[model samples]
Target: MTQGLKIVIVEDDALIAMDLADLLIGMGHDVCAIASTESEAIVTARRCKPDLMIVDGGLQEGNGIDAMRRIATEGFIPHLFVTGDPQRLAQGAPDAVIVGKPFTMRELSRGIAAALASGVPASAD
Candidate 1:
């Protein structure tokens, strides 16, 4: 298996963030940081330099699409979006790898695999 990847989670829900962190640890991946807002996500990604990022498409304070765009300006980092409204994210990022909300482990794993495999770099535009 590949080495455990360092990851950052951008989720506004505290419980969900913890759950995601726990799940990632169980999967042998290390969660470097968790952010609850777009600004926080950008700062955390910069500080943590995680190999991957799992972002929520909709956030109460700040949305994920804007956060990803800002972070992408620094450099491309493998990432996936988890959201209830896939179409919304699709409209903003046509190439993004997305996992639906309330996903099973299998689905999340597949999404992560696809996200990692995708070569398209994140773009601000």
Candidate 2:
């Protein structure tokens, strides 16, 4: 409903990454970059400085939560974690917005809204 956001997606699965990119584009948001690993995610975030990040909680090469924690050192960026184990993140980060795996577009949208609304500007660690 607001202006389209610049987003970076941190997902390891190639198909999932493409799907998410397409979905975001269709939703009027810009998909600046897609990162398949934690290092890539960190670098991409720094280079793109996206308005938001949709990160997979468990990456093939590294952990998404670790990537986010490292990225947060630079500054807080609104983010939503997509994970199969939502309870883990919820318990660790009660204030953070998280969406479980096999999520619906509606769920993703709500998580994005909540993350942006939070706007705490603090490290996600």
Cα shift from native, residue 97, model 1 (Å): 0.3
Per candidate, the number of residue pairs that clash is 0, 0
Ten-residue segment with the worst summed lDDT in candidate 2? 116-125
Worst 10 residues of 1 by lDDT: 116-125
The lDDT values for all models are: 0.89, 0.86
lDDT of 1 by residue, 1-125 (tens): 34499999999999999999999999999999999999999999999999899999999988998898888878888899999889878888888998989999898899889888995655446
RMSD of 1: 1.4
> Residues 1-125, candidate 2, lDDT per residue (tens digit)?
54599999999999988998998899999999999999999999999999999999889999777888888889888998898998886765666688998889889889889888987532354
RMSD after CA superposition, every candidate:
1.4, 1.7
